[model samples]
Target: MPIKSIKVRLGLLSIIVLTGTMKTLGQANDTLLIRQLAPVTVSATRLEINEKRLPAALTVLGGGRIQIGQPQLSLFESLGGVAGLFAQNPDNFSQDLRISIRGFGARAAFGIRGIRLVIDGIPESTPDGQADVDNLDMGAMRRLEVMRGPSSGLFGNAAGGILNFQTENANEMSLLEGQVTVGSYGLRSYRFKTGVQKKKFQYVFIATRNQSEGYRALSHMESTILNLKLRYDFDSLTRISILANYGNSPVADDPGGLTLQQATENRRQAHPNNMRFLAGESVAQGRVGITFEKTMGKHLIFARAFGTKRDFANYLAFQAAGAGTINRTFAGASFQYQFSQKFDLIGYRFRLGMDVESQGDTRRRFDNLIGERGKLTFDQLESFKNIAAYVTQELTYQKVTMLVGLRSDAIRLHATDYFLTDGDQSGKRQFSRLNPSVGISLEASSKVNIYTNLGTSFETPTMSELSNNPTGTGGFNPDLNPQQAVNYEIGAKTYFSQRLRTDVALFDVEVKDELVPYQITGQAGRVFYRNAGRSRRQGVELSLNAVLAKGLTLFSNYTYSDFRYREYQTTTGKFDGNVLPGIPKHAAQAELRYFTPVGIFAIAQVRHASLLYADDANAVTANGYTVVNLRVGGQKTWGRMHIEPFIGVNNLLDAAYFQNVQINASANRYFEPSQGRFWFGGVKVGIK
Candidate 1:
């Protein structure tokens, strides 16, 4: 099938949607949160407040919208209509999902960086700001909240943004549900969920298995996951909750990135070297966390502790140090206290919190002898430890709210190289940083809020990045320095009516000593890091959520980003004024949802991305493209039993596009072609 490129008249569509919402009469705001009609509570900023009252840009998606007639593969499935957010590489199991918020995480080679991922008050991203979601049980996700812009003032280190997730809780008496799905390209999935609530004891258990031969050759992946949540309410103001999860992925293969010529010739074929080396990853991971909360008078206290262990192994495309294994263990704890008081018409809230975390890794590497490991090349023990404290104060008077926060972190990195033939590159380093932020929100009208914030972020290179050693030795990169960024943003939220709403924001970010990634010639999969002098990022975001008619709604967003290096100078050339690679200059998405009286529902989505560069020089570009997708489903209930069946078509227009681009890749290999016109369908049955 050949792909066709097209454009959408988004301005005209926006006008039509605005006109429809203007004529709707107030209907008591009793609609479900998924409709985006009711106000939502947001906790992504560490402060519980109304989404409309938060000074920062925030997006809250209810669980209902997240899983509606969709493949439970990635969070990108539900985040299409969000501004200033970009996600790609859903089919690349080795690299995981590549997500960037406001261009902060665009430098990542594998997994995510800069942004923080938190699930149920436990940090999913490590203290050094590295995250991998391959083991995450997305099937049990209940809610998602995204906070954009710098946020290190509250959440220490690499808090350029936040992704907060909540899993299903025992909200009802009992629930038992099962679902099985099969799709194109040998996709199979099975999921089961059960929950029960009795008095002060509640528990939720979820299990999922997903297997796929993938849309590309040598891209097979399979995983089995289990998640459990247990809670005991002691009292209304005092409670404790425990969460546990385990995941195993025995077969995950990497197709590897390809050049434009290679992708155009055959999009489904794996890289030749990747096939020869049997490139892929395998993992066994488990985690457990506990949380406690207590309230005394106008004061509240919260505590959390968690531990995790993972055994991982991977094979890369090259032979030198291509086979790698990691035995990793991590543990963390946090304590927080908040005080509130009211003085007539003025109110104040003070918060203080402390966190400590440690991670250790036993890493070893061997030569990849054409699908088999040969001799040991490198062996090392690496650890990262961090301790941090934060304090925040908030004051409310009349129609205005002001918040100020400060945080400081002490970080230490150590590595012990046991490969003595290499002269033993054992080393240690320490760093300390302090960040501060402030925000103000004004209620200009009952339906509008004007806000401004200035926030700062600090990011350290992950252990994997530090250990990549450009010299082909086994030690941390002594020259790689941490990056610091400051962001300023102003935004407005307007509720034209209960059926219509809009959010607009403008932001500017300045970075110093920005970390950059590049590849050496012989080491195909190895990524080496360097530092750029300075960089500047400016962007605008606009979003709209409108209930156009009774059962019809529209959610749309647009983003314009201009990111560039201001004073970057490398040994090769000066990169000043060059555009950042991997991120598009313009991106937009529009989604329409409709429901019929016959228990039928439909979702239509259109997304577009402007041309992007694959290298810092902007010499190589991937053409712009627009894609459409649709999902249709229906549900019915009969005698305590519920059933739903759905079908989805991605790339309905068969638009030619690249699903992922490897930035600054050597040998001009960057493009990862996307599948054209994929189909998926599934049925679910349950008793509640």
Candidate 2:
């Protein structure tokens, strides 16, 4: 069938389905309009407040929204409709996944940078502002929140923005659940979850195993995850909580990028060199955290501590001078207290907090001889430490609320080389800064809110970015500097009708000493960074959610970005006013959902992006494309057990496009072909 005809048929089908739904269920406005009152949030300012009253560009995804497409494997599945955020590379497990908020994290080669990730109120991002989301157990998550724009004044290092994930907790009941899923390309998954809640103690536990044969050659993966949460109530006013998580991935294969010619010839085939080198990675990680809270009269006090350990090994397609083994440890603690008081018809609140973190890595490199370690080539120890103190005040008068915050951070980084045959190389560097922010929100009406804010943020280079510098000796790059930016933003949220909600934001950002990465010649898996002089970023984001009829809902979001380099001089030439690579000029997402009283649901979605450059010089580019997806499921109950089944189809249009790209890559090998049309189905059983 022709692509155009398919698109037309899909549109007609949507209209027909919606019409039938309205006719069957009629206009049930009262039921559809029944929503939770004043959803509470903490990511915007680290204080629990109504989301509508927060002065920031924020998005929240609950389990209902995230579980629409069952058996979730990647964050991209649910977050595609969030404006100003981009998530890709779901199939490339070797590089984990790529996520950028307003173009801040686009330059990362592996893991995530320039963004803060918090899980269950504990920082997952390291002291140097780097994190890997691949090991997170999505099955254990209950909600996620995203705060876009500069936020260094609130958080600490690399606070370009914030991403927080909260796990499921025990309620006032006990329950057990299990799920099994099978899909195309040998995909299989099994999960078990349980929760118990009592007067004095409560607990939640989940475990999962996943394996995939992959859509492309040499891209298979297998992993297991476990998550546990425990809470004890000392009294009505005091409590303690503990959390533990572990993940192990015995194998995650890497297919490597393909040149344009290779992609055109055979998109399914892996790079020829990958099979010989056995390119892949193995990882194991564990984490634990504890939290204590107490409330005394009008004051609240809280404290938290966490620690993590990780072991990693990898084999690259090309042989160089390293062993691919790494051992890392991270520890952190935070303390805070707040008091609220009112005077002369005005209410005020003040909070004081401190945070400290330390991280260390023991990295080793060895020669690769046909997928096996040959000879030890390098050994080193690298560490980063950070300390920060902050204070915030909030004042409320009438229908307006005002907030101000100030924070100071001190960072220290050091490196030690143990392979002294090439001469001992040791170095250290220190950085310090003060960040400030101010914001105000006005309640335009009962259902409308207007907000704006001004803030400053900073992002430091990750350890990987400071390694193997081209212009300096091999310790830490002395020439590299932190990127600083100032942001001005305005936004509004309104409910035009009982069933319609919309949010819109506009922002202008100015950045200095931006860090940019370039691939070195003849280096297959190595990357270096340099500080570009200046840049400007401006954009608009809009989102909408509406209940069109009794059982049908509509959701849509759009982002328009205008980002450019003000001054940049590269080794090849001077390229000024060039469009930033890796971000689309325009991107959009739309979805239609149908739900019935019989526990049946269906969703149809569309995602589109405009053209994007692949290099800083704008010499190469990737064409824009659109894709469609569909999901359907139903549930049945018997006695105390419930059974559910689901099916999904991805890339229904069978569009051929690139799913991931290596920006500014050498040898012109940039494209990672997307998986074609695929289907999956699964069944689940639970008891409550």
Candidate 3:
């Protein structure tokens, strides 16, 4: 069907549903009508402070809003339009999705290394503040909150910002929700969730099964997930909660980027035997947390502790006709305490907190090809700890508020490496840093605010960078040091008559001792981690939203980046200017939604990215591309049950492109190709 027709039909359906509901309410009791007409949100703030008064850059995605348009399956995809945020996934099954906030960690390959992800106050980042959201299940979430800029002082290690996924409170009677989807390339998925509440106890369970033939050959994947949460309230001021999650992913092939000739030949076909030569890894992760809260007259106290563990095995094919397997184990614990009061000196609200975290990682690599067989194996163990304390006081006077926070962090890093073949060992190294931040907000009116912030953050070297042994591909650099950054931002937000909203932000970041891989001669061209010269990145982000009429809404966001190196060390040991790699100059997204009378809705989305350099030397660049998507769905009531069905077309224009690339001196480049345009649709049901 045509996009315009879809929108027209959905608009009519929404009108019908609204009219019918109004008529039904007229016949019902006054109390019932009042209950049904109540405002939808009251939990925007965790505490008593008015949400409209908070001096922070925050965005909230409610569960109902998420279900209205039934946005993309990927949570990152759905977050595309948020200011200063960008999401890119090369393929559906790939664990490596690129996410950049305010130009931080834009070059990360696999997981987000600088951002912080939290769930119900449990820290999700590793000890050094690195986190990957590969295991997050968005279906069981009640809401998602994103706070940009350095939030490390509030939650340690959140240098880039913080993303919090809050699960539904199971204490609301009993409910069940599930969804089944089938689409192009034989794709299928099933997600089920159930929750029960009784007295002071509550429990929630979730399970998911997904499989797909994928858009490229040998790119098939199968995954299973399970989540369980339990909560108990001993008293009005005391509560305890526990959460556990497990996931398994088994799949084939790395749908690597292709050359120009290869892409022209066939975009859907994977390299020969890509599937047969593919073997996937299995990952399992879990966390446990405890919280305590107390109210003392005019003051409140909050404290929490948590521990997490993750295990994984990833296998890959090497160039020398050998397969390598990387086994990893990660574990960590964190604790924090906060004291706050609504009124203080100068009629200001003050909050002070301290956070401490420690984590350890162990990685083992096995190369079976060249061998002394098992004797040639390599192993490494690394550990890190972060300790930070901060105090934030928000002074409110009339319509103006000032938020000031100062934090200092002490980080300790240690590593040990062993080469099984020759009993060679590498020494350990340690590093530390301190960061601080300040912010301000001014309410120009009831619906408009202006804010600004300045902060400092740093990223320490990881175990992979400091301990990997040379195997013709890459070698470890034991002397690598930490990378440091300073960021400044100014932003404005406006809400027009509760029907339109807009936000804009400008940010600049400067860094020293940046980390980059350099190839060494005569050492089989092994890439080693080294500290690059100074660099700077600046960007502007704009977001706008409008509710057109009653059942139509539109949203859009755009970002422009200017990133370059002030001085970079080349192979000849000379300092030179070069542009940073993996950063696009421009990116934008727009989305439109329409509601119909038959409980149906339609949505259209478009995304565009400008050209980007693939190498630090600025010698290679990838062309830009644009993609479009369309989705249509509707909900119907069958007796006392509700059912919703949806169909979506991604990459409606069928544009072909590569998400990222690695350029080498030999003119041999490696690319991670993006999937072509595809179609998907699904059905969802709920019970209350």
Candidate 4:
């Protein structure tokens, strides 16, 4: 089916649903426990604010909603309800999870780019705009804020969006907890957590270990993580926080992608090349960060500093120099000041901030001799440094609020080659960018809000992307430059009553030098990057939450994307107007939650995605699929201890689906079969 037809059908369906549900607005509010709905609060824009008052699209998830009766494996498990966000490859730890917001991050070959990642008020992404989620601790997650759309004015490079995560702290509660989980395919997990408060000090700590035999051959993994959060309060107006995280993954084998026929024959089989070369990855990473904030009357100050180090090794399915290792160190700091004043009928607040960050990588490549490292082939040191300053103003008058932001960034990229056999390839690249954004929101009434915004963002190619020079063996790919975008968006939030809430957002974006990925023949697993001349991305997102009855709740969301290349040409082909690969045109999710006064809870979820193309040529398509999942759990208190047991069944209908698709893969190896009918059960013991 054509994308236009699908869009039309979805439009009709949305109208019908909205119209039918809104008819009941004339009735009285029937919320049983309105106070328990947990209103969403957003802080991704550098300040704590009400969602309805913000001029951007945002989604929030509480700790229980994200962790309860969940596998706690990857972000894919927690991000299902966020519209316009697509996540895949949950089981492929070697590549991390492929996450794309709107269409910005669709080009990432490994880890994440085109988006900003924040953890406990500190940046988690590297200076060059690359982030890996293997170190994120799902067990300690407290609140998650997903800010969708361009935000470069506030966050600088790769700010197509922001994902801010705040973990649990002892200030909220004090507890000691332990959990053990077992599942199919030789799965085992153990977690221990503790939180305590002493006088003005509070701390929360968590440790977890996970092991899996995987559903595919040669795809086993074992990893351990530790997280610590500490905070001190000097009265209510001043505070300091410390966050530390460490992760070690000794083994994470990769089951290389397969062709459709190969997957159809035996989905569990690993690629022959993968088995021959022992494809996989190992990562040992750690980071420490500190944040301080002070407020006095109408003035506020904030500061943050952090450092991270990573030792990584990867083995691919190809032979000649297909293995690589990177010893990376990254550090950054930021400071901000805010002033507020109130007039007779209007109020305004202003903020000024500055940031400095740097990243250095000692990278080396070697031949993959049947999973063993061979002779060294290439060696280089790559570094990226950044300095930025930004200013923002927020003004309010009656029921109207306006926001304006501007930022300037300076960046330097340098690399030094150690392998002289290919001649000296050292080089440096510099860039300076200025970005601006403005937005306004109107409280039409007590029950509705209308908002609109225009913003621009940029994403510089990562050090890894520049080092993989497609044309020759070199230190940096001088041709690979930064990608820029302009986004215009409008949205509305409505509350029929205490029982129903709905959000609708529409966005249009134009991109220049859009980054894209492709694989060269004979380099089956190695990915190369290139630029598309121009592209246009437009999307409609809708989400709703309803307290259907006393103990039942309904939540659902849908995303419709129309992304295509406006003018793009390459040696392989001319993709003047092709549907962007790796993202479905239509994606939707529906979840039902049933809770009783007794302490028992049940959840049923259904997820669907329309078929999407796998390559720029649009000659091959990945079939769409629907997956159903069910979870049930109950809580019981026993004196000073609370015991909770839960079980979950994923893909209840045993649907045939692809967990991941390697975009523009060589030899048409694009499919990674998803697991079928998986079951997991666990028990948690906690004391408060």
Q: Which model scores highest in lDDT? A: 4
Residue pairs with clashing backbones, model 3? 10-595, 10-596, 11-596, 12-597, 13-596, 13-597, 13-598, 14-596, 14-597, 257-671
lDDT (tens digit, per residue) of candidate 4 on 1-688: 3434433443453334333312221111234435335456677988666788899998888786788788787788878889989988888888888888998788888888888999988898887888899988788898889999989999999998899998988755438899887776777889999999989999999999999988999889999999988899999999999999999999999998999999999999999999999999999999999999999999999999999999999999988888999999999999999999999999899999999999999999999998888998889999999999999999999999998999999999999999889799999999999999999999999999999999999999999999988875878897888999999999998887777888999999999999999998878788899989999999999999888886788889999999999999999899988999999999999998886555566899999999999999899889999999998776656556666667778899999889898999999899999988888777777887
lDDT agreement with native, every candidate: 0.86, 0.82, 0.63, 0.87
Pairs clashing within candidate 2: 322-365, 322-366, 323-365, 323-366
Q: Candidate 1, residue 18: CA error in Å? A: 31
Reference-based lDDT, residue 615, model 3: 68
Q: Estimate each model's TM-score.
A: 0.95, 0.94, 0.86, 0.95
> Over the stretch 1-688, how does candidate 3's per-residue lDDT look in tens digits?
4434554554464444434432121122234222222223322223334434555566666664454435234576567657667666536454456676765666554566667777776766676656766566767677777777655555544367767777777753138878876666666778888888888888999888877777776567776777788888887877777777776665533554455566668866654423333433446666666666666655667677776777765544332322334444444443333454454444555556666777777666554332212333556566777677667666777677666666777767665555445554645555555566677778888778888888777777665556543442222465577778887888887877666777787888888887765433322112356677798878888878776655667778888888788878766554456667776789888988676544656789898988887667676677898989888766666454566667777888878787555333122334556676667666667776
Model 1, residue 407: distance off in Å is: 0.5
Candidate 3 to truth, TM: 0.86
| For model 3, the run of ten residues with the poorest summed lDDT | 21-30
Candidate 2 local Cα displacement, residue 78, angstroms: 1.5
Where does candidate 2 stray beyond 4 Å?
1-39, 172-174, 471-473
Over the stretch 359-408, how does candidate 2's per-residue lDDT look in tens digits?
99887777778689988776778999999999988898888888888899
**C-alpha positional error of residue 255 in candidate 1 after TM-score superposition, expressed in Å:** 0.6
In model 2, the Cα lDDT at residue 387 comes to: 95
The weakest ten consecutive residues by lDDT in model 1 span 1-10
